[model samples]
Target: MFTSLRLPQPVIDQPSRLVLRLGLGGGLALAAAYGLAFAVPHVSLLMALLLLSKPGPALALGKGVVLAGVLMLLIGSGVLLVPLLENYAVAALLLIGLGLFAIFFIGTRQSHPLLSLLLVSFTLIPVAGVQGQALALQVVHALAGGVILGAVSGTLMHLLLPDLRQLPKAAPHKPGVEDAVWLAVRGVLIVLPVLLLALQNPALYMAAIMKTATLGQQAGSLNARDAGRELLGSTLLGAGLALLAWLGLSLWPSLWMYTLWITLALCWLGLRLYRILPTRHPPSFWLNAMITLVIFLGPAVQDSASGKDVLTAAVIRLALFTGVALYAWAAIYVLERVRLRFHPAGPRNGVSTC
Candidate 1:
């Protein structure tokens, strides 16, 4: 995408092209998905956006297709569980906890980076305000629609635009049962409390997002200090830009104008997000901040916002990701140290399980 301009030192550092690809592909996919008219357009596009973060193929082409199918079935199954537990709040919450545990456990493996999206999307099927067979159908269709569209668009993107970083493949390995269990424990520790907080709020307006952001970080990949600084800077800049664009729409006061405003805002935001991902870009939080806004504040992007509303949301989101980063780093650092002390010669595990 930057053929004329001399690429930076790590040619792969720039990913503005990827964001553009996501915007175009995600737009087309949303157009098709919205034809259903009853589906949540933002949900599908949001899924596509999350999937865009995942660079390589989805679980190997053939396996990914199978995995997608399995995910649909599992989503349907989750829908059934909701009604069965509606009369029992305890069971419902426990089910949610168990599901969170599983998502974290599987997510510990680098092989399944997108599993966090898959798991949360499926788990939420129960609470998607659906019931019975229709619930199953809707949940399956919703998730499948998004996942298929994302995968197709991603494939086309790879075919047309060469990957900025053609990092050579290394053999992927599965985490051991012990590693999975420990990771799940840490995730549950961090998530269960947050889940409880969300439950306390009647709307649960931001809980799922917070949980997803929290688990999105894997252990050992980025240090907490770097993650904190980057998150603070990026959230401040990106939120500033987003809130400003939001203010512009109130002046124009037309749907078309608002649409134009959103398109431009996303373009600018996408550039910032991509710039933040480059090697010089600090690790962690910028991308999470971007995604968090989409999931939480997307529907209102083109609408007028109260200064209080914007400020409150921004502060809450900044806190959410920052807390997640610190927790992730602490868990990794503490666990690794304990493991080393107990078995000083054991093979070192570099990955974080936060």
Candidate 2:
């Protein structure tokens, strides 16, 4: 339904090669997931886009996707072991620890393994005791579907358009293990208290997960101005966009209709997302907003009309964003002063080459 004339001028004039690949791949993955009734279709497009968005060889992308997919399955399945912690607080704390550790292994520099994507695949798991297995299985299946299809699409594009230009990338040095360890320590100290506190409030838990995942992504920049803007602006915009999707679907609900709607939205928003990027993997502002829309509003399209869930999610997201941003900025500010005051010996910058 996206006719040529309806597309934006930037899209028509200077279409991003990576964006085009992501859109085609995500759209196809979405169609397959919906058509086949995948367990967690909502994740299919997101995973596809995430994996395929990196500017690299198709084979390299495929390899990373496979590695990440296996990691996703392993991590998701590990949720089954959460009961071992006995205390819910202990479980949350352990999970936070696991998240921070992996966050280091993935490196916190300039987006090597991509911390945000890594969190969704491994870190943001729900510790629902026995049900954790089922949740994990669902996540793995959804991820598998996306990665497999997205990789295929990327490979195909590479074959067909060998001359296609890739996005410019910054080659930041890999962080030393000691630097990574220190960063992990900082991450745990900052995140553990918040994680425990968030666990106390069911409504606040998801927000905490979102906030922390975002924190990991922004760790490289430690730019409060950009991070705050991305967090607040994207979340508010995403919530509003989700409301629109819900309203539209509520009026004329149909399986095919909603599928088409989501597909188109993905394409349009994805293109927009790629166009606004100031760096190779800087904060994903509009994409985050679109994700917020899809994740929060997608369900309302099917559920009976009530503004309660959307409103609650919106508030939680905003509050947690504010809280997390404050902590991140405060931590960064103090760290800068310390480094300046006592020039500690380690990696000069926080970046990952992975």
Please report the candidate that would top TM-score against the real structure. Answer: 2
Model 1 residue 65 lDDT score: 66
> Which lDDT tens digits does candidate 1 get at residues 64-170?
46656876776667666556555776887787778777777666665453565555564456555333455446546766666766777666666665566664576
Q: Which residue pairs does candidate 2 place in steric collision?
A: 109-351, 109-352, 110-352
Candidate 2: residue 345 Cα off by (Å): 10
- Candidate 2: lDDT of 200? 51
| Per-model TM-score versus the true fold | 0.65, 0.71
Worst 10 residues of 2 by lDDT: 298-307
Model 2 segments beyond 4 Å from truth? 1-15, 59-69, 87-99, 109-117, 126-132, 152-170, 173-182, 189-191, 197-204, 207-211, 247-251, 255-283, 299-354
